[model samples]
Target: MTDDTTIEIEEVGGHRVDADRLRDLLTENARIREIFADSDVAGLRVLGPQVPVRDQDGPPFTATVVDATGNVAATVRGDLDRPDAFEVASTAVVPNPTHEELRGALEVLHADERYAPFAGRDDVIVYQPMPPTSDVEQDDGTVVRRITLGIFDPDGSPVHRFVAVDLRDRLVDWDLHGVEHLDDHDCEDHLPVGVGGLPGGDTGLGQVRVRVVKGGQELWSFTVVRPRDSAPTHLGKGSGVELRQVRYRGRLVLWQAHVPILNVLYDDGVTYRDWQNSETQFQAVGSDPVGPGWRVCSGPPATILESGTDVGNFQGVAFWYDDGELQIVSEMQAGWYRYISEWRLRDDGTIQPRFGFAGTRNPRTCMRHQHHVYWRLDFDIEGAGRDIIEQRGLILPGQPVWHRIVRETKRIRSPFAREWRVLDADSGRGYRITPGAADSSADAYGVADLWFLRYRGTELDDGVGVVGGPPSATQVKLDQYLTGESIDRTDVVVWYAGHFLHDEEHPSPHQGHVVGPELRPVRW
Candidate 1:
């Protein structure tokens, strides 16, 4: 942690909460014990604490509790300053593995006799397994989660063999294809890691602060996270850089802005977008040459890039404030694919949300792929209510036209013609979104380029980021949320999906590509 970053941890109602404190609070609650009886506490998370809930004055601090066998679930939501307002839900929960939890999972395997051959090795590196090939056969494939790890051969080879460990510390015959030799353990025994808390993960909560000014007036002040604090717990691939409490020009502009749908599709039938399908490491580490050599990024960093406090573990999100536009650059390592979600907020209020794609050494390095990032922009202009989404297009060569979106629906890009804007209906203050030149349109794949829908506390990514068992990309259909909610003069969410094609004839790290949209302030 450095002075360059700002911790988003604020005291609510004179109550300071962390992961442990929240754990203690829930475990002591008589109602929780009654509802989730006879279950071991598997995990606890305080990810979304600031985002306001419906009918709430400010926001609620929410936490998820996953049971030992990963069956039962619990949720506690309360106002930040009010301790008694905590309400608990008894089921339908997913939990992110903490650093210590993953470490414990690995330690459980080491104690078993079948893994005794390499039990004493300190270099026993663990990673989320590359999803089974059978799961990739459908659009709605289920990615199997397991404690897949490799033993580092300290004498010569980096890794000689890899293995999988079930929840009971039993060894299972496993590979990229599928699992076998499980006498009792099924895929349910495979504890889901969300591909987070890998070896490079550091245990702590951190965020970077950004400030942009124009004409002697500060235009923006916000904290940047790889994915913001209240970002619906996006596993790894389905989450991107987010801006929290974004106050623009002295007014709160956005409550949160993040990408919940980040997916990479290969030419072969491989669809990667879940805990089993992604890794949250760095794209580059410790001076890996700005441009050349045997360059690649894998695993977590040796340093804690985000400053402030510690609650859980997150990796690959740091930024150094530039004299020009605030460069809130966010990079996430996803096994072979590296994603950079950058938010360039300039002094002039031009916010360019850019996403870049690079490659690492992997089986599919040369394979053609499409990287889609669906950014859910929560524009709280003036306030959450009285906000509207308008479609901008050109009537003639230079003539412009605007079409106000009234209902929740999906829209396509009209290349250089069509653009979009989200603004306060009462006032004209808003931001216009224009896709980048390199951002290709969505293909025949079952996904739209743009979507506008009414805001809801439960509408974040189909609640599939953290998984109890296997995860489903087919379940990540953002269109499922477009169930005819009115979008006129009310709280709304604008989901802009960016498409980047990795179809270069000679694609490599040297040929890195950046794609996203530029959000310029309109008539603010």
Candidate 2:
């Protein structure tokens, strides 16, 4: 709740599938083991396949397995084309540097005498450069894995330079940008609200049950699945906040709603997502280079006071009421930015959903970019029946025009057509969505703002690849899901994108940057 009254928060034991055990099988598979070539399998990440039904025991799932430390990835399935009943994968995919692998990159630099000024410092921040660049790498016999790492040194350290070092040490390239590295905490007090990966660790299996009540009446309820980091939405299935059995007052609204992917496009044409290089701890990597092409701090700079808040809940659900609404919130860190998934419901059945974009520390913090969050809203209306969707157009004459979405397709918001509604055709009860003021239109990389499609088990996400893959992977590619399906009178899922701009110039950054929509009750 944005503003709230008396609220209560608690956690209940819940398990949809044995994700951990399933991952174990994938890791132990003979064929999969060979792919890694016995690299120290130091850490592994698997994004579970799309599991449409939140409840129902052990549905067969195919998970995308990532061995970041080992530099390879694959897909694992319970049932495959083979009779052995399962398949490890068809081919091995290269993944980005792991949290540990990033640390190893730091060591690579320390060994060189030129970088001796900051030798043996564990606080160095390291991460892949953002977008098109992060994805750009030479696939030659000598694979080039470009990396950036630097930290603020008050004594004016030599941290403002771009260095490309071949692991073999034969090719160490440097391009310096002389930005002063002041050892100060000037920007520490401006830490943004809602840091991600709150109460971090083993996210794939974490789920929190929440119930919102006000003045003795149940208003909203659901389960929050803190999903694992994915290679990209396309390769994996489960990630982002999954709200199950969402209810308003005593009636059903959305069966499920969650973020399939949040794409950020910078002025430099670098695209980032919620699943790429996600933060698993207190600090996440920041964007844009601070000085030159270097600046390292694994989490936020040590100077930032509030970036290190203890993430509570070793295992369950938690909640609390605030101001005038009942707010159920969760956080996740993708590199330097924190994604805050908040669902707020007031006593009057008014719903205000928001996704926050907050930063830690980095040179790119001042760079102009756009944060677009895609939410898969699976609407049940009164019950999972043939429902209808509609959009409101500009006020023509004295009346605002309303057009019902007749087919499965993607949509872009405009001043003329700015709102939409989904309803139970028979009963005619539904909700209206008013876009956030900051929610911008489609950008060069962010194709469109919304996709109103008929419900399909296989269409959970646009499946845009994000792990620094091919040039094609960087695109939202939601158009693939538009292969015409009727939505005239059927269960529908509305994918809404909240596009917020992060500019260091205009619009006071100190005020805060949060973007989302307000779903007001249309008619009960």
Candidate 3:
């Protein structure tokens, strides 16, 4: 040994040294060499004892040291491999890769440092896999069943169960669709909630801090500041209308509605009334004033019409001078109503129904089609003088169809466009008429086929919009119709069976005379 304190030579100048002293010198040299190698750049030289072999080599000594720049200076050992170890020690201080880059490369493996001790002594290094726990339970006591993340181990078993975390609540929950895992920092305090740690002892699994917001029975809930600690702000505003559930991008939004009218377009001043409210308030509706839409009408005790009651009380009447006689046409529960009586025009020009049925069925009431009775008058009437009645035919429960038949008049218009003749004419060629466009002279003088189809429509009180869809004719514009202005549209709905679309060539249906809101079908 070179140092006097480490010298154990009993006989100097070719004498044996003490084994303990030699061992002590070698250990000191190794420590000094390692420190110097870590700090050096250019190099320095170190001297130490080398392992002795029985059949040995030329020299039996080792030396390793480094320069100031952390570069290996030189190594003089009997074995050449000793220099390589010295070089590795010197080059160990290379620049460290960024944490982000390292994490990217190792995230899949869950290669995160559980314990990184001071450098040089790495015996206590520990690594943990990502997503450290599974079988997480929710506040409602339901176990999370799905996860969108995967787990991995470092040494032995590489697979482990992980639970999805609720970001809002900061709680771990299982999800089958995705594997859920945590960042290294979040796993610090998190403990394994399930079984199976290491075999010998409890694995030093850490715990994670999670502030979970408990769930409630409400459809929608969010955090809100209350007088005390923060509380949940529920979306359901007192539950006027209870819905099983609703979603917006898979998130529930609960709201309440109590008023009958729901204003959809406050900017445009448009609103919608609930169907229930409309039904309750207006049990009976009548022809649209301002042209041809149905108006809520209440008369004859405005309740739902009973089986044998008069719907006539719900409608209006139109009068005309017919062959020096006064005539009236209207509708009631019994169907259509028509009244005719001799007229003596008073000098004062006052008009009245003289000795006529309060309400009577109009010309066409029942039709024998395929030997089946189809109620076609269950519809609404509209326009100047209400045209044909339109209705949704639901006689067959399984299938709903639409039907419109023109009401034949005692005096019907001629197809030739020349004149009006008796409906029971020489040929009874029941002509079709369409509400003429106000500006078109040709149509103003006579009706057209296309206009007839457009003018009549059958709609039912379906929950949404109209059951049979919008009327055939372009619906009377809201602005024009509401303002009492005439638009090109002139479709009317009325209550009459088979009077909606009549074929003069086909035999007429059972026509009837005016009685009272009751139909007394008469074969014409």
User: Which candidate number has the best lDDT?
Assistant: 2
Q: Residue 122 in model 2: shift from native, Å? A: 10
Give the Cα-based TM-score of candidate 2 against the true structure: 0.74
Error of 2 at 431 (Å): 1.2
Pitting candidate 1 against candidate 2, the one with the higher TM-score is 2
TM-scores, in order shown?
0.69, 0.74, 0.13
Off by over 4 Å in 2: 1-10, 13-45, 54-59, 67-70, 79-83, 87-115, 119-148, 154-205, 227-240, 276-318, 397-400, 469-472, 507-512
lDDT string, candidate 2, 187-241, tens digits: 3223222211123343333444556666566677766555453212325423455
Winner of 2 and 3 under TM-score: 2
lDDT of 1 by residue, 1-524 (tens): 22342222221121234656666667667767776666544243434333432345334555556553433456677753455567877755444344554455567656766667665565443443333211212254322324544333334232324455454434454353342221211111112223234444333333445555444556678765534232554222235666777887787777778777666666654565533212244333422222221111233222112321111233445443445555555445444345566677766778887776654322343456677777888888877789888887666565547878899998878743378899888888988988877777777552778888888776666554333222244324787788888899988888887776776565534223777788888787
Shift of residue 350 alpha carbon in model 2, Å: 1.9
Candidate 1 overall Cα lDDT vs. reference? Answer: 0.55
User: Candidate 3, 471: how far from true, in Å?
Assistant: 14
Better of 1 and 3 by lDDT: 1
User: Cα lDDT of all candidates, in order?
Assistant: 0.55, 0.56, 0.21
